[model samples]
Target chain A: MDFLIFQIPILMVQASMDGILLGILFALIAYGMALQWGVMNIINIAQGELVILGGYIAYFMYMAGIHPAFGVIVSPIVMYFVGWGLYKTIIFRVVDRDLFISILATFGISILTQQLMNFVFGSDVVVAQSNFGTTMLFNSMVTLPNSKIFAAVVSVIFAMLLVLYMRRSKLGRAIRATAQNARAAKILGVDTESVYAATFGINAALCGVAGALIAITFTLHPYVGLPYTVRSFMIVIIAGLGNLPAVALSGMGLGVFEEFSDYILGTEFRIAAVFLLLVLILVYRRFKLARKREYLK
Target chain B: MDLFKKIFSIFAAISFFVSLALPAQAKVEGDTIILGAAVSLTGKYSTNGEHTQNGYNMAVQRINDMGGVTVGGKSYKFDIIYYDDESDSGRAAQLAERLIKQDGVQYMLGPYSSGLTKAMAPVTEENQIPMVEANGASRSLFTKGYKYLFAVLSAANQYLEVAIDLAVEKNGGNPVNIAMAFEQDAFSQDVRIGVVEAAERTGSTIIIDDKLPKELNDMAATLAKVKATKPDVLVVSGHSKGALTAIRQISEMKVDIPMLAMTHCDASKLAKQHGKNSEYALCAAQWHKTLSYSDSFFGDGQQFDKDFNDMFGYAPPYQAAESAAALLVYKAAFERANSFDKEKVRDALAQTDMQTFYGNIKFNDTGQNIAKPMVLFQVRCEGDVCANRVVAPTKWASHELVHPIPSWSTR
Candidate 1:
């Protein structure tokens, strides 16, 4: 009742703008989650750490006197190899096991990567400075940073390029085939193992791009990766796997919802609201499906 | 075969007897007094936990180097037994109990954060052991009337009290309007209480008050409202992360608020991470290196800083300094009581009114340090470089306090 949103209409404009920009970044990370989930049939708990690792890569470059914006290109390339090596070493072993086993293994990787990043990055909250300036609108009432605008632009471009690569490329077709029927694709002489590895590597590359953007636009921390993981997971569940347009729309929706909840319920409840919204969506769908004698359980 | 089995049984019996004798001697013979801590060595508080451990380690080395604590007839070297609580409160409490009941550690130093310390408080109080903590500053922790919890650092309510006092003094005893955007955590909430009380005492008007967004991310709404109100001063009470977010947003928005003050802004850190945007931002600290306060064990403030930096390879922040001071309080209590008895140490700790390199240490009835004064520091930037200057109290002001900061375009 004491909320100030009612007093200031400009705050709605500001929050919406901030949330949309942030959501674009969220959607980018979620796209990666969706890719691996679709192709490899595995849930990567270490997805957030991968993002943070990518951010750190950009951060190290910034420290070395290179503009951090270049990380949007360079991080994905480095992370692709990192992801390929990860798949070849540990992920391959869990690929054929039970889903629970993969989940548990990725959870261990999450902890390991978090600690490793902490040691390498010195456990500090760091941000790569773009110094891109700000944009004022509505008679200077709502101000948006240029870094956010840049991040959104970069994310859209990456998403489009990825869509093109998936549709037109040969490896992309094989990856799609593997996603449709891994056992059948293997019988038809399509290297399913390489497809799975490529799928995970490309997924990690997408996360790297998103992470570099995040480091430029927002703050990065060693332990902060888990929240990004949760946000991407929520977005994937809401948008569904391989649904590109839905992913972007739902990502924006989540961002706006977070901003509104932050204004209405207070900042402390923002994460709680996201988790609660996920539960509500799942429960509502469960009931809707239950009417057809099909329960989620 | 029967002879071989008898020899094997005899050999096993002798080895088992020897092991039992060794442990019995280890338990009974006390060459050094052991203190225990449930520090967070591997989780969220790991960074600060490492600093706290280093503080404790440096203090122990110094005490032993100076021929340790002498109690009546014998001198025992100081040693600590540490357990990693992993930043979990349940684990902290469980480890605290194990330290006392199993490891035979009587003296205790508290953990890193208020939440972890709160979890361990009941264990210490129930066991009637004295725990002098450095970091747990939540005011509610003290109001519970726990006799065994003596804190070395100032309570959370005292965090920003000095900033208000300095602001009022600069305003020629007139009131200044303040906008508060505080993080809704126990520590920050406690800081708000202190800020509000100080503002009321100084007759400052609360033009705008808002809780900051989570993780201190995207506080543009609060900043916009502050800009609209145009309050003479803005007092923010968030942790370092919140302060950092505010700095970035404030810089981007170019909102020309006159003065900005915050809690937990270590100016050196701000200057390092955020360049010129950190300029003119005032922060209150419990201890600073230029205070000139000293004790018998630790030399002076400058000497303590040098010693700590030489040992830890970085300048000691207020947290590290407070951790070291906590051990100093223990040493004072141990020497005063002349025995390691829990009741005697607690009694001595209650009556402590001494001075250390950190500050004057005296506890009120609530076990909060009321005698010590918080120091104010400001980040001063020149073109591209930034440095923190101690700027208040006249006695400790290393530079003039820059009040009512210049407008964004002018800077």
Candidate 2:
């Protein structure tokens, strides 16, 4: 292991800052995924594609000579409708089905979406230039990109607003009731179908926000969506469904772990480490539950 | 009713096997010669795959429009059957076998990346099919001593060697400290080997050498190390995404190194996307429009660039240029062989020596084009528009090299 990170203490600060900010963005996508999984009981395999689709919206705006930060505002709005359409056409049919069925259906959508995006966007690795510059700390020894800071700030605001919306809004209450018991909510004269559609739409909109931030902070490729999907999936598993604060904390933890592993093990193992953590967490939870004569559902 | 059901099941099983045994068209149907290729149409390599397909299509069209290949006093047109390999090496090998055994393809075209090429090479070699590929540039591909495999592009090791030498020269002939990041893939790893060798030859010390993941999105950790070490040169190679990510992160971090060399600057359209931020970044290229290479069909490099842009709606990157040159090599080989026999055509390909709009195609004993030299270019910006200008080899130096890029504070 490379102990250089421990030797140079300032690099630790840099890696942590980068990890936490990046983790905030991951939490945003996981928030959406957790929402749909909890409310509709359908795991979306195309969650990353939604993020990338949202990023493409911002990239198009940038191509049209508009500031991409405006994408944070425009992308979610457009993606909401896109998500609503997707639910109406595809997801609605798979609702109330087996989890494996939904997974397979959404997996197909993921591949189809990747190809359509490749055809439309030319499969180029692209970025929207935010030009927000860098923020130097401790006499310029630790540098942080302002765009990443912007992304983290925006992500936190969105997460807070979402939490507030879910608590106070009428539609939000309907969604919570459906998540608690779909049949009971339906028996109580709640429109369960509308709640399902709305939940899926909101999840997609959240992905759009994350995607736009990534467009500014990192690179975008049609095929790169799978990594984000896996990361959000891992985060949601660690945090469990419907727990917003835990999602944020676990996302940051995962991000920090990634940066440290990258420094210690080298970048070639960065993705491997993330996946390895996923397997370890799964096994740990399995054993922890099995000790009480229980198992994961 | 049971007897009828059994009869129907038997008929269904027969039909399934019948479909499996359906015969494909022969290798040469009528006056057409069928070539097979498995390129990435939907995966990570799709962009370069599209370029390779476009190059192949452009050459096939131009060659047919001029006059099809005449073999044994009989004119024959070229047609290719393409399979989408999904950018997976295992799938590429399977498709190569399917192309030969199922589609009855006796001739083959190389896939997009070095990894896929390495996979398809063995299948073609085992089948004794003649294949000319454009994109696979890994040095190991040449070292394998495959008899029927030919390449039109320079080896991957030659890509950024001169950039390291140039760094030493700019440092007043003293050994320089170098930091390099390459993707963990066949092509990029070979490029890393080249840099390691170059470092040894020049007595330069590598301060930080990092292997980036294949699907890379960020390199902040590696860039942070470079900042801490303060190396003289920073080298990065990971195809288009690597180039774009490097410029984005380097600019954002403002990590200043005297020299930065990379690959795939043009393929990623870095000059256009990153604009001023991408300025002064040196890039290694297989071919450029400013080169003085020429052929009868596409004329000089400038003419081919214009024509390709007209056809594809974008400037042809070196990947596309080298791909188009592969077709020229094939056409010349076919004419020299004067027959459709695979053995004669293999010999003809081995003896290929000609000039095309991309470069001179002359394969050495190892099946690599040794006649062409890799060119280094710098992304130069005027006002807000940045363009790549040839800067090395002194023969086609369109602009003087910019050394020790202006620091971020000054910019």
True contacts kept of each: 0.25, 0.77
| Strongest candidate by lDDT | 2
Q: In candidate 1 chain A, where is summed lDDT lowest over 10 consecutive residues?
A: A288-297
TM-score of each: 0.91, 0.93
Task: Point out the worst 10-residue segment of candidate 1 chain B by lDDT.
Answer: B20-29
- The 0-to-1 C-alpha lDDT of every candidate, in the order given, reads 0.84, 0.91
DockQ each: 0.44, 0.61
lDDT of 2 at B186: 82
Report the C-alpha lDDT of model 1 over B66-178, residue by residue, as the tens digit: 88877776787878889999888999999998887767667789999998999999998998888899989999989999999988888888888777777677788889888
- CA-based DockQ, model 1: 0.44
What interface root-mean-square deviation (Å) does model 2 yield? 1.5
Clash count per candidate: 0, 0
What TM-score would you give candidate 2 relative to the actual structure?
0.93
